[model samples]
Target: MEYIASEALINARASTVWEVITDAGNLTVWESGITAIDGELRNGGTIRIKTADAGGRTLRLRVQQMPGEVMTWTSRLPLGLLKRTRTFTLSLQAGLTHLTVKEEVSGPLAAFLGNTRPDTSQHLNEYVHAVTNRAELLDRAS
Candidate 1:
């Protein structure tokens, strides 16, 4: 399996962070990479994600929700040949929220695409930063 994971300590409550990150309607308010997404964000829902440059892709993802702690989404890539899983986990540590985001690719073609595809760490980092910023702002307003 090929994966990318990022961890950071965000100065915000886990619940607040979770709420901000999972709300698809508010995604554009924080996330820079996504142009738009349609469909409800929940278990067994289909979502259409439009990126800024790469056009768009639709994913029928199976969501695993663990409120305030973790949320995971898994889906099969086009042709059902490659599997992709994305996860976000939060933990309370020393009065701060420890946040981790990870995405993994697996399948027979995983190694090939993993090597050819550009590094996704940068995209993940952007997501984390945006989430952190939004969470902080929301926390301060409350």
Candidate 2:
């Protein structure tokens, strides 16, 4: 399991954060690594996020939970013969929010990511920075 996580406090309200986070069609508004996404927004719904990487691989993303200040999703993708599970969790705090993403690679290729993926903390840090930029949207309107 190659686990990583991040936490951030935006200079905005939870309601504002919730709106930006739940807007399924607008991931490019924050996540820098996502180029585009097309799909539905609901429990068990699927979505495809065109990542920063070229060719825009349509990742297998599904909402693990929905309805409330917290939402989660699990993304499955193959790294060679191994399958990877990436879990994203979001939680609201006092006028702030917390977001975390964890990745677990298993099967025959498990060692591939667990051994080769360098700078795990750097990825999480970038994610937090990208998502926290949502504060700009809230600030602009307010």
The models' CA-based lDDT, in order, is: 0.80, 0.63
Count: clashes, candidate 2:
0
Writing each residue's lDDT as its tens digit, candidate 1 over 58-140 gives: 44567777777888878786786799888999999999999999998898778777456655788888888888888888998
Highest lDDT scorer: 1
Q: Write the per-residue lDDT of candidate 2 for residues 28-142, one digit (tens) a residue.
A: 7666566787886567788777665435557766775546454555655455465555555556667556666666656665665554555656766776677678755676689
Q: lDDT score, residue 56, model 1?
A: 58
Model 2 regions more than 4 Å off: 77-83, 92-95, 114-121
The C-alpha TM-scores of every prediction are 0.88, 0.71
Model 2 score (lDDT): 0.63
Residue-pair clashes per prediction, in order, are 0, 0
State which candidate has the highest TM-score: 1
